[model samples]
Target chain A: MKLLQQTILEKGTVLPNGVLKVNTFLNHQIDTGLMIEIGKEFAERFTDSNINKVITIESSGIAPSFFAAHTLDVPLIFARKKKSLTLKDNVYTSQVFSFTKQETSEITVAKEFLAENDRVLIIDDFLANGQAAQGLIDVVKQAGASVAGIGIVIEKTFQPGRQILEDKGYRVESLARVQSLQDGQITFLQEQISVTN
Target chain B: MKLLQQTILEKGTVLPNGVLKVNTFLNHQIDTGLMIEIGKEFAERFTDSNINKVITIESSGIAPSFFAAHTLDVPLIFARKKKSLTLKDNVYTSQVFSFTKQETSEITVAKEFLAENDRVLIIDDFLANGQAAQGLIDVVKQAGASVAGIGIVIEKTFQPGRQILEDKGYRVESLARVQSLQDGQITFLQEQISVTN
Candidate 1:
């Protein structure tokens, strides 16, 4: 987490409307070395949870989740945002609102991929309002699976993303937490363990 | 490649309207072990090309591409389909038509991440009409980057995707080539190498 915090300070850019762009490393243009480290961190943190699968939304979250899934030696399922031709008709779907994109879309996972006995660890690149993670958790709920926890690369603590999931009694962990983004300067907050609390 | 062929034959579903679903292990629900192998294969195939970066589109391509990037010890960049707030304004953009979704959208990669001197290897989940890969190649060209080759997990040989790229003099490689998918049966064609030739 210290290395991630340092990387955010070095490469991250703060945009207007409380948007922090780590596209240079985390989301868009990824550093595979850093990605592996992030994945190892998540795997090390959640190794004791008996996670059978790592669930994430499409686009940004797939990379880190893939690394974590690789480390955990489990399957990683990315909920598709678009209703593609290849996606099956029998899917568990949940509507998600993206505060960044300012549009609501449905995220879906095939019912057969997620089973009732599976313990899923949700992963994402950023958690602002927590709508995306909530949608993934909803899909897991529909499949009757257990929510092991949530792993986030970056979290905007100024928003209520982490609080929303914690209120639901879900274990949420983020590598980088931005307490505030003001005047092109970013502030960091110490990570807290919600599961033990 | 044999393992991939066997996976498609066993787990893939032939959807209505020529849609072959391999999401059980390839895209939606990803098998991390198989993904690592796919990445290793791509790395081995493109090792002599001097690829500095691996380029892909969002959602599906990021996972395999990430592993490929890791294996190659280079960076991986995924083009964004939608313009988001966090993405920089300065980007190399191209339009891509999705036959599965029946729509066209613009894809963009940050200009700083892709350089004119960089040799890129394009990676994608499917090579169906090759429109997505073409769009990526266009973005790379816009940045003045050289494309070493294209790596695809599943290519529909019956479709015009691979031919379009091959006719354009691009080295395109696919792990599993489906000759036909009809009546709930899938026929696979052996992979052909264009890099050596």
Candidate 2:
């Protein structure tokens, strides 16, 4: 988490809006070494949660979640942004509104992937408004699975995403927590506190 | 690769419209163990190509590409399906038509991530009509980067993808070369031949 925070401070760009552009390493472009470390961090955090599967949304969420699933030695399931032609019927679908894209898209997972006895750990790249996380949680509920925890690479603490999920009683662990991005400066929450501590 | 072929034969579903759905293990839900082996296989195949980066399209491609990049100790970049709000300018863009989706979308990558001297290895989940692979190759070309090779998890040899890439003089390595899916049977091009051989 310290490495992630430092990477964000070094390579991340603050857009005009509240967006933090990490295309260099996290979003558009990925650092596999950092991602593997992030996955190990998540596994170390939630190792005793009895997680059977790791679920995330398509595109950006796939990389970190895949590594997490690998470290956890479980299967990784990514909810499709839209239902493709081959993915017809018998799917647990949820409508998610993306604050960034400013559009609503349905995320879906095949019902055969999740079951009542499964414990799922949800992972994603960013958690701003938490719509995507909520959608994955909804899909897990539809399959009668239990939510183990949520692993986030970067979280905007200024946003309501963390509060919303915490209010819902879901444990959320974020690697980089940005307290503010005002005046083109990145401010992390509790910068002095070590992640390992 | 043998494990991958066995997984395809056991779990891959051939849809009515010539689409083979391997969502059980490759697309939707991923087996991390298998994917790790896939990354190693790709690393072994392209070990001498001098690849500094591994590129892939989003969603399903991220998993295998992530592992490949990890094994190769390089960065992984996934082209965005569309230009997002954060990814505004200075991008290498290419148009890709998804035969299965029945729609065309533009893929974009940040210009800074790729360079003229970069040797990139492109990886993808499926090689059907080779449109996605072509789009990635175009992006790499636009950045003046040379493509080291292309690695595909499943290649439908019955389709024109493999032939097209081969005709263009690109080195393509497919883990499973599916010959036919007629009559709901998953047939490989050479079932008896070992991938290691």
Best by DockQ: 2
Off by over 4 Å in 1: A191-197, B190-197
DockQ of 1: 0.79
| lDDT, each prediction | 0.89, 0.91
* Model 2 bad stretches (over 4 Å): A191-197, B191-197
TM-score of the first chain alone, every candidate: 0.95, 0.95
Model 1 pairs whose backbones collide: none
True-structure Cα RMSD, model 2: 2.5
- The two-chain DockQ for each candidate, comma-separated, is 0.79, 0.85
Candidate 2 clashing pairs, residues 3+ apart or interchain: none
Candidate 1's TM-score:
0.93
